[model samples]
Target: MERNFLRRLITAPVAVALVLGLAACGGSASDPGTPGANALSGSDQESTDKYTTEKVIPLEEVDPAQLDLITEGTLRVGTLSDAPPNIFIDETGKFTGFDNELLRAIGKKLDLEVEFASTDFSSLLAQVQNKQFDVGSSSISTTDSRRENIGFTNGYDFGYMAVVTKTDAEIKGFDDIGDGKRIGVVQGTVQDDYATNTLGIEPVRFYDYNTVYSNVRNGQIDAWVAPSQQAEGQVKKGDETVIAESVINTQNFTAYAVNSGNKELLDALNSGLDAVVEDGTWNELVKEWYPEREVPKDWAPGSQAVKLP
Candidate 1:
């Protein structure tokens, strides 16, 4: 009886474990009913359809003054500086990555100055909702529960989940993650949801990508469940960590988060996104940042009305 109880305790959702342990390193809360909570399941259509809007408002229709931005004529974006390729600050001290650059192009279409600020992934959504920033641009995945707290623009990217382990660790992939192996995840991310709610394994949560990846390197954790893009960014040559496996997880399309009440701002950003896609800027950035990644046939960024070139 004691052994079975211990097993059950260990296998409980990560959120529950965090609650019991009073850990500050986890996400806000887990809602199992949220679509795409399980990265291992769902179809491309199922994931992308909800984020697709019927129409995108023209940029000319949006008035920056009426939008109540933190700073007029500027988009104050909250993003992570540690996660590279997608969202990170370059050595030149400029925020220049695929996600930020794409947002900058979108800003150009709207004639708005795009300024970025760094924040923890765990607090970004709430900060956006509270108007600390005009938008959250951390390559956030759209989910139903998240919508209740904040609004999201039409998806600009899809994602893949990966299992990053030390080269010598026995964890080969997602299948090898559970059963008492110490797994690390960045708090408040979909990767956290996958380990906590989908796989039924409590994870050691960290506040940022750098810390979690450090733990994986130092043998403090056996594996790190992370977004494939960020994992690839952190695991460089001479780093003994290897991406054991990665699986396509378009279950949730990644979009920028805005305050749910800010319909005007959301529509305007969506419009700018469509414009970027139309101008070939979107395609150019995709090829530049993710040259090796093959976009799924069924998936493209922007609204349903926009067609990818």
Candidate 2:
């Protein structure tokens, strides 16, 4: 009878422990229905929080007089709607790229909200000049002709004009692209000017980069000329095209453009650019967008020569 009583005590405790263990496992604090639970891992949460934070710049510390904002506290920016690596709308409907991120950083420093206006590349400068936009943030190259109508900030990037052709095209280099061959270029761009004025070729014009790529892929055009980075991006997508050679080897730097009369706004943009460069924000953006390309250490807007790393 004593032995039986001891066995009962041991078995009862064992059964009770197993029941509690199963109950605890069924309703853990880390489970899906737990209150205040997070589904994302720790690293994902950090990354999400980094980009989703609304308030990056301390507004209270910024001087309102310096901003000279167009709409009280908003910076009106004009950019291309489809140019990738510079400014473009993604599949997820998010505005992102090197230029977009840089503008966002500039807005943060000035304690202003950025309102982006999408338009064609050809119209960016004219819109800025007409005061339709406070600034143009497209990958607008700084040239003497543009300076006559718009004030350019210090150049933030240098780009080369490249020629791209089909992988099996007989064109091996710029020299092989004869005058009789049909070439495609974005209208009102340096490439267009080169084809018409410099190369003495009557080139076909397209408004958007995708159209140019499609035309070349479908044999609608023999070759296309655009910025080296833009051409490289298309090539990197595993398309049936390749960057044949750089036609314009000169240093063409790109910068933000403002109305010629808006000195105050220009000064504010320069100040913001200085802040981003000094605080490593510019480097972070460059690393993110142009991971394979090198940004010069002493590079500032309008700096003449940029050697890629």
Candidate 3:
């Protein structure tokens, strides 16, 4: 599965843009005491508190043998720890997010313990395909190319690609990003593909999200294109950035992917997902993670109505 960008940015109430000077002026986005400085102290404290108090469903009732897990009693999973609102390593070194929570819930249902192995987003699918991990849950979007090597459960969320720029930048949206504009995108992501193949603009590639936000804030790049939720997370963390409303609204269905031909495990995941949706767990998660948007009523497993290049 291909990686997609954020949705959180699209739903966030627009904050007043901060005026940051150009890169040539030695402006730093990481500078403290500045307006919208990307500070994480508050976020770290909150994450620590949340992880400490959060209650999970008990798993004593379900048996792992029935589910046929990779490690007998454990669900070995692979994911990226930097993607917020989906899966991210908190300041306390614990994985926390909607995706992590959902996977934990699935583990409870299957009567299996979840053991997560963090990897680079670019290598997540390959690891899952090679059976190094039984499943991957990194907000992965089901793509034609990925379907060849992996099997995806029903999509749990929709991810939209967005363009983020410094508040004072002239570029407003995708159309404004001409050849002269330096665009930053995560390497191996759908955003990278879109910037290169669809828009025909070669983007300044970054391996991590923090670098993209820093570059944009420092005026090193004209704009950063990524998942709306991820971009929104960065903005919320005090980055002086603004998400363009005119985004590339690709309806990418994000799902958990298993190795190709692992029909038993795939079926079990789909069943667990169906249970969550039916029991209102899915709705609760959507509200918790994406309070700005309504839960999709017709969403189901393997539902990818809109395809992207």
Candidate 4:
């Protein structure tokens, strides 16, 4: 996985262009009528207050034997290899990013080993529910619909939604998104749900960030609705793409996904998360990875027992 991601990062320019060209020729945009394409609605969302306010179980009370982990003392995590700064593979082929590193810290608190595997964002949640991985560390937003299938730890991060477009394009901001524009989004993402349900438009769904952002740069798509941190990472100098607009949605806090049946693992993670937050590891990682974006005063990670420094 590390070698594959390294190769992809090294050959991104050539590979992205080829992928965009092929996608354009084959009409890869998802049909709105298709199941899971534009299927999300307001009903999918639920208040996260329960997760935010729930008292974390004491760390000592967490029994690893009851956690039903894939491995006895290791957390086999599922994450993306493309979305940067939060959950991507670095140039050295190391899975060291904000989300993964934060999870590592939590594992340390729990006296567990943290291991990561790269997978598509589309299948990550389902894979976690199926116990393919002990946790999903892809900056997943916890929603009511998603909760039906899998469980989530208390939030460790917040995020912003962004729209990326060519510098010369007419789409300047979020409001500029309307009918008759070719908008791209990662499949099975909150951005996909927003573009489909809120904007009332059919979106071109790509499996990974590289492909969607590639289409934006190549003019094959007018805009890409993406996570702000990832958009900033991808839209580098002279890339011909810019993050035209970004809006913070504090309602949906980003958390680690776990299997629904694993209550012990969920409670254990929440305890570990509170530990990190209380010790200031969470704040440090936020400052390190998200230097450009400030943490909103109204928001903080972990349970109410822990506060950001």
Computed on alpha carbons, the lDDT of every model, listed in order, comes to 0.75, 0.61, 0.62, 0.73
Q: Which stretches of candidate 1 lie over 4 Å from their true place?
A: 1-48
lDDT comparison, 1 vs 3, better candidate? 1
Q: Which candidate number would show the highest TM-score if scored against the true structure? A: 1
Candidate that scores best on lDDT:
1
lDDT of candidate 1?
0.75
**What tens digits encode model 4's per-residue C-alpha lDDT throughout 1-309?**
000101111111111100011100101122333322322222212223655655798889887777788999999999999888888998999997899999999999998999999998888888888899999998786665676677888888764567799999998876577788999998888777666655567889999999999999899999998877789789999897888876554345689998889988989999999999988998889889878656656566887777777
Candidate 4, pairs of clashing residues: none
| lDDT of prediction 4 | 0.73
Instruction: Record all residue pairs in model 2 with backbone atoms less than 3 Å apart, i.e. clashing.
Output: 154-301, 154-302, 155-301, 155-302, 294-309
Q: Tens-digit lDDT track for model 3 on 184-229?
A: 9877676665565545566898877878888999999999977777
- Could you tell me how far off, in angstroms, the CA of residue 294 lies in candidate 4 after the best superposition? 1.7
Task: Give the poorly placed runs of model 2, Cα more than 4 Å off.
Answer: 1-62, 65-68, 247-251, 302-309
Residues forming the 10-long window of minimal summed lDDT in candidate 3? 44-53
